[model samples]
Target: MTAATAPTGLGEAHTVYLDHLADADEYAATDLAIGLLDAGVPAERVLLDLVAPAQAEVGERWARNEWSVAQEHAATHISEQVVAAVSAHARPDPTNGRVVVACMDGEWHALPPRLVAEVLRLRGWQVTFLGASVPAAHLVSYLHRYDADAVALACALPMRLPYAHQMIEACRRSDVPVVVGGRGFGADGRWARRLGVAWAPDAPSAAELIADERALRRVPPGQLAHLADDEYASLVRRRSELIDGALAELRERVPAARAYTAAQLDATVSDLGHIVDFLAAAVYVDDASMFTEFVQWLVEILGSRGVPVGAIALPLEHFGAVLRDFPRAARALALGRAALPGVAR
Candidate 1:
């Protein structure tokens, strides 16, 4: 199939796999994936075309409130199983140097990177699939110990870009060329460019990049001179204070919040913290759209779960007022507020 087209039967296969995910039927999901392999569908195609897109839909289902967190987790677990089954069914011996694949610190979305690792393996690279949230120091130590030819880092959330940058630099200090991918880098890998690392849009491109040492190491220097303004650093230092203050403001402004159940209150606190964290990351990257996009996503997620847009608006207004002295942060908050629905604005 060409780059723009899905294999003839794959679309139907994706639908069936998603149905299996929705049912939380691990055996059925695994059987379906392996059966595709048995039918002569390439293993990489099963992973990238079938399991990957199904997992993306699982996330969308949760975002739309059609699936609970429990359901999403169940589906994700099943997808992981299917990936493992596909990998085992088509195991290929490594014919190239070792590549260490891992998630950035604080990033728990390991499945995307796992697919990449398996793809690298299928293409004949020895891959050490270090699962989710591998810390920078530990990752650096492992790179040194194993003398990795290259490392592929994954970050599924844009909010973790700061940690991703740090981890990328740590690997560089050990003389390992780094290639990063995932939604965290933005769909175009713009954030990865901001950090001055090689970026792959998917597993196939990542495998190709890893094969060409010169291309992988030839990225331009990071364009983080704007960090000299110190807004990102200051925002991070005040993260806890910002979250607490936002929660206090929320409780005072929204009377019902004071009587929220423990679970509801925890969720509120988490959302507040995410706002500050996402804002900090945006500031770090000097991109207001990052914060704005996150606000839009947060609104959809919360709105689907019965939250009013005002619930999100109030926090944006609060953070804007509090960070008024920090130009970059204040500007980003303003853009985020503008991105809210008309009623909230």
Candidate 2:
């Protein structure tokens, strides 16, 4: 079939974009991104609609041993180029509020922060793109220099957790309200709230957040509520059906396999809950990174730990099940539990 004859929708188009991303077809991905941008797909939605899904697919392929690290790196490079191009055109309204979008020091993944900036800019808020790996001192200076209305940080790795928190604290010390997004902001989200800053799990929700009254006023105790309500509320509300049921079934299969501690299981459950939260944020706000990151992390971490993702109830399993009902996770988990004697409970 000719490319022009191919079907189109968020789903079909998304698959093509992902294939190009995984293949590191930089020219193709860039053109797809440009076409998406020309289609009036808001830059934020493009990230949510195109880039994030593309990243997720690349990640999934890597997890399944389908794509190599070089392939993943190539895909990321292509995505960065395209997303950065779109971000370059993000012009904010002159009289609107201002937001500073940055990546914390050592967090070079600029896609999420860039995505947030685009959405806010599309919403008529002035955005200053600080690019990637920004130092805290420089960000503070920029906040004062620009008299920024809000600060947004995008993080894409767990390795930069400490730096991300430090930057948020620094912003708060400067009396600058901040909003944080990215897939890696998982366990550290509460820290952002505790520092009296705003948090958006994704770009689109970050736009809605900038629109909220809370984004304008002093940060409140409930400011985090919007991060949950608008960003991740849906996934949190409905994840029990997937995670809880899966865990319960696993425990039933191997009653003696409960070598893993309750504390650990509880944390896993909590992480799954947060995954739901992130998914909700992505769904409602048009930010796919959260969902992508969650699944990606699960796959990578499990693989590193010699755990098969099919042994877990992660969303990938949910997605895989939808695609093939393969029970990849259940089988993997069962095998992993059998091999790792201490990880069962």
Candidate 3:
């Protein structure tokens, strides 16, 4: 491959990027990463949104067992391709120094670091995207070898927490500023803080966090807590619309008065479960289980009210952003409710 010729214009670039992402399930995401580079979207933006976000989404699905190992492997292989292509695009620039990104040992999720590398590189920083599962000693060695402006690590699971702490400790010993992030961190950001490291909730935020190292370094610990609070609040606000809408819909449907046979009860219970699942999903992302639990309890309460319909239905329905969004929640609801018997329907 002499390199797919770079897409000629912005419109052409849009076409190529979308086309690459279209049957993305069919090709390794790495191919799409190359396609983005070839389309000239800047190595950084592609890494931030397209490459890293795609990989994170895949990892999330895998955690939920929604994606098989093969699918995850395919995605990772494509990510390697993208990283290679982006590296080829890198050239020494007088403008900015280097930033190094790596995954802590026990942290096999390389895509986050890769995406962060691309983001820094795109912003004119030199970047070295070390692949997954790097040990603290190795990272410390690299940090000194490269004289990195900042060191970033992706810690995506609770199991990786010890390793992450070690890596951050290594950087701190060397007096190097470190940044950590991943969905695994979730809303409990205090751990990152307690570890005495800066935390980026997502790729874009990471880029911003590192854009001016001295300023970030200058901030006192007390000030940093304020920033963390703001970040968490923003995430809640971002999802508030969906959560509120779902609760509204759940308030509408009333349970029926007539008693039903076992078969009817089973079907009705299943349907109600579906409705709960659907509504739960509408309010949360990648959190179908929690949503299902909350909705099912709501359903049981509504069913006992002597109401003609499950009161939770209409309130949850109001959350309908689209029909497809409801399936995961519905599936979750069905699975949960299926276990219970003698619950008021």
Candidate 4:
């Protein structure tokens, strides 16, 4: 069934599952998922319908600042446990070739891909799930050793797209067909197209794509001729300088920032770095919306935590001014600036 129509009672099961996650009751969460399996609910439904949606809500709660990092971590641990419990209960033998599932390097959000891996296993693929932040070299080496039919890479954040491209290329060099998924590829997998890789919107689609050898390898070449401009490269080389300058500017112009505690300063630095990294990724893909979308997300995240719009406005303007000679980077920053709430274009 499509996302709009979850199996009967799965909606209420989702609510109860979320409550269990919020309470950090791992035992209850596992029991609830296992209980579904016992009640004749498909294991795939247990994962995609029940566990997947609940994990997404966990992220939403964390993003809205309603859940502390510790609480979110606790909830995620329980979800992982539930996945393990479900996988063990529905141990399907492999009838297909091996598929290696992993998160892209520098991407620590492994749960989304973990769910995908389990679904592939349930569908009878000899799935080997390599969880979280796998470097490209090690991944290619492992693929060679394991004789993988295809490798499915996961990237959750857009900022990791550059690295994702690198990993995809590494897999190609090793003669392994690659299929990528997750938010890093964009909601419609447009960025994956930009990188010229096969992309699946979700687990089932990924399974179907992996099963279709001709279709998986027949994708068009990446449309990255924009990289010839060198803007993306220059932005990467100057990331450190850009973040340092932004932080210094913040300290000078925002008096409150000058007195920020250690944790606050680190977080500000991280936010500045994220802006630069996301802008660079936008430049890589030649999409202004990439940067603009990230700007909106950053604003909401910081705004929820009591940061003023000016705090974000200043950095966008600063990046724009600093990258004045780089047309694509400057233009992306300008579009990002226009996206800020209450900010004049």
Instruction: Tell me, by TM-score, which candidate is best.
Output: 4
lDDT of 4 by residue, 1-345 (tens): 223433247888888888888889998888888777877899998999988988889999988999999999999999999999999999999999999999999999999999999999999999999999999999999988989999999999999999999999999999899999999999999999999999999999999999998899999999999899788999999999999998888889999999999999989898998999999999999999999999999999988899999999998988888999999998998888988899998
lDDT of 2: 0.63
Clashing pairs in 2: 231-281, 258-345, 259-345, 260-345, 310-328, 310-329, 311-329, 311-333
Higher-scoring candidate on TM-score, 2 or 4: 4
> Which stretch of 10 consecutive residues in model 1 shows the poorest summed lDDT?
1-10
Candidate 3 TM-score versus the reference: 0.53
**lDDT of all predictions, in order shown?**
0.91, 0.63, 0.57, 0.92
- Compose the digit string of candidate 1's lDDT tens values, residues 12-61: 88987888888899998887887778778899999999999999999999
**Which ten-residue region of model 3 has the weakest summed lDDT?**
222-231
Which has the better TM-score: candidate 3, or candidate 4?
4
Provide the RMSD of all predictions against the true structure, rounded to 1 decimal. Answer: 3.7, 12.6, 13.4, 3.5
Candidate 1 colliding pairs? none
- For candidate 4, what's the RMSD? 3.5
The whole-model C-alpha lDDT of candidate 4 against the native structure comes to 0.92
